[model samples]
Target: MVGVGYTLMCEQTGPKELVEQAVRAEQAGFDYLVISDHYYPWLDAQGHSPYAWSVLGAVAHATSRIKLMTYITCPIRRYHPAVVAQKAATIGVLSDGRFTLSLGAGENLNEHVVGAWPHVHQRHEMLEEALQIIRPLLDGDNLSYSGNHFEVPEAYLWDRPETPVPIAVAASGPHSVALVTEYADALVCDNPDAAVVRMYDEAGGTGKPRYGQAAICYGPDEDACRKTVHDQWRWAALNWTVKAELPGPESFVSASDHIRPEDIAQLVPCGPDLEAHVSAFQKYVDAGFTDVAFVQVGVEGQPMFLDWAQDELLPRLREL
Candidate 1:
């Protein structure tokens, strides 16, 4: 489907602007809206962080027809699955049954809030454990759950929507993909390349919904687009994905380990043409993403951004 998601770039966007953008996104023909879940924005990176749940509440009222979701909420870190279940249930009702909970264990940067649990694969393990608790609870329970990572006593959501909520898992590996295939209603991937799509299908996922995401930087001058992208996205350069070409976070870190400030110049594109930007998304569709979201690269071309994407790409993609 034609969906839109934002990464919560703390640098230039905030909750208020996010709602405004969401309103426009829906009016502009977007069917679903997803936002990233991060406790704090990277200080050396994008430099802006707002509470995601509060922002989602605002979005629920700001747009009437748009579906809201966490691109991937980290239920294994700070918040327990029960808490997430409650919050997600509230949002689902508030949105008139239009909320989906996209779950993930968490990441090193967000979960590594020193003084807290310090581990890499803990979130994944916690995720599997949490799901076992969550599915039962969502099916209607007021009982306590005692898992290794999280424990609760008689916690329950008295106010839940009538329809059963769908959980979309953000899976990147074989085990996690299999977990999503077996348990989750949908699966999400950031890259949505051919190989990434293959992972889900190979894991035994049939016609389940799978979504993909990518960012685009289109402007008048190619040099300007690349420069702006590098300025704000230098942090992404630090990400491990650039060099190793592997899907893990370590590869992102490895790429960042060797990436110079100028390296992103070649990696990110600067196609001022709307057709080119739309073509970028076609790769995702060809690779088999049932849903695709685009993070607009820079703020300079906001109007041009919507004008191009909505008119040229959205109509054709709205059918997906």
Candidate 2:
């Protein structure tokens, strides 16, 4: 069966609600759960950004059957690669090996807090350097490394899980995809772009799992769903270059000022239509993603959305 998952958007929800949602998602039959690791919400209206690692720890104790992972965490800045490795190892122990450490080249919005944000190319290089440190340390090696962007004098994970935690890297362009092929155990992407997957496979990621996220606003009222998405996630319509370069939520809000509520439907499926929701998810399945995480956009209707997913959506997606 294709693995179906839910995302706990740490950028938008408080820690308590995030843990509750994890439990609810598991009960609703999701195979896994992913949480975003963000220092800021994309827009002020979204209104909640908490430390994801702490929330994941609570989630580990709250849910037993569901697998857990960061949708994508950046080890390149605000966190050293060694520290990221230690955090992943602890989460792996807490979740009993259910955690997958998904990382990215990072967005300025999150990494800028450290007072230095590199260009895209430099960021990729830093990510490769980070993986060099992270992978071996997670595998129980004591690491002392030096690279253009970082240095690890001597670091080791003392409480790693029985198995090495799987590492995934998010990629959208050719350069990032190359990094994924070289250093990642799995591939992660925000969109259902087959070309990205094909590139990863042809570039030596042939057998690795491809992971992607699908965002939707599921509510009884279609117009309400659309409005909720525009209010909370319209920043998503901005291209990757813009999304990665913006430094904060204020910047995103201004950049997304031109977006209208209806425009969101083109990017994210909104409303209660089961076929519309299923079709949006099928794009990921068709794109060769082995695991898909469903993001219920906005904070208001999550419980309702989970019930809808369990009662209607999951079965329909399984047929795909």
Candidate 3:
């Protein structure tokens, strides 16, 4: 069976509320929870960006059964790979082997705050170097390493779980898919694009768990859900290239100023129709994603969505 997951979007929800939701998600029958690690919200209207690591720590204690993971963290900038290893190890220990570390090349939106963002090629190279240091350290290996993009002098994790944390890499294109096949134990994507899975499998990710994220707006009124998605998640309708380079929420708002609610309605699964939600999830499962995470776009209706999902959507998705 494909595992169903929930996205804990730190960019929209406060830390305390996120933890409370994590507990609720566990009770709602989610197999796992993936939290976004962001220093800033993608849009100002989203209104929140708490430190994800601190929130994950609280979640570790608050929920006992649900799996925990970083949807994607960029260790190339704003953080050293060694520090990421420490954080991953600590969370793994806290969650008792239920933590996963998902990584990416990162975006200028968050990393630019630390310094000038590198070119796309350079960032990928940096991520490669970062992973070289991170993977070993997560396994409790002492590493003294020097690479073109990173340097570490005898660093290791002392609090690692008995099982090393699984490392998943996010990839939206051929180059990144190649990286995932080469290094990651799992693959993650924001879209249910079949090309990604096909490339991963042809390149040797056949049996690995593939995670895909889908956006949904669950509410009683279809039009209201569409409006909410437009108000909050229209940033998603922008091309990935645009999203990677924009430096702040204001930039996102300005970039998406021309977007309309109908555009979001076409992209995200909207409203109370159980089939709409189930069919949306089916796209990911059909594309061979072993794990699918639903990103409920708006702030409200989490409880209603969860209850509805447990009662209706999940069973239908399992049938698919």
Candidate 2 per-residue C-alpha lDDT over 1-320 given as tens digits, one digit per residue, 9 for 90 to 100: 67999999987789999999999999999999999999999999999999999999999999998999898899998899999999999999999999999999789999999887998878878889999999999999988998998988988788989999999999887888888877779999988999999999889998789999999999999998999999999999999889999999999999999999988778888888899988878898889999999999989899999999899988887887
Scored against the true structure, residue 273 in model 2 reaches a CA lDDT of 88
Which candidate, 1 or 2, has the higher TM-score?
Answer: 2
Worst window of 10 by summed lDDT in candidate 2? 175-184
Clash counts for all predictions? 6, 0, 0
**Models, CA RMSD each:** 3.9, 1.0, 1.0
Query: Where does model 3 exceed 4 Å of error?
Result: none
Give the per-residue lDDT of model 3 (tens digit) for 194-261: 99999999999989999988889999999889988999999998999889999999999999999998
TM-score for candidate 2, residues paired by index: 0.98
Error of 3 at 304 (Å): 1.6
Model 3 has an lDDT value of 0.91
My TM-score estimates for the predictions, one after another, are 0.86, 0.98, 0.98
Scored by CA lDDT, what does every candidate get? 0.70, 0.91, 0.91
Model 1, which residues run further than 4 Å from truth? 1-12, 43-45, 237-262, 316-320
Model 2: clashing residue pairs?
none
Reference-based TM-score, model 1: 0.86
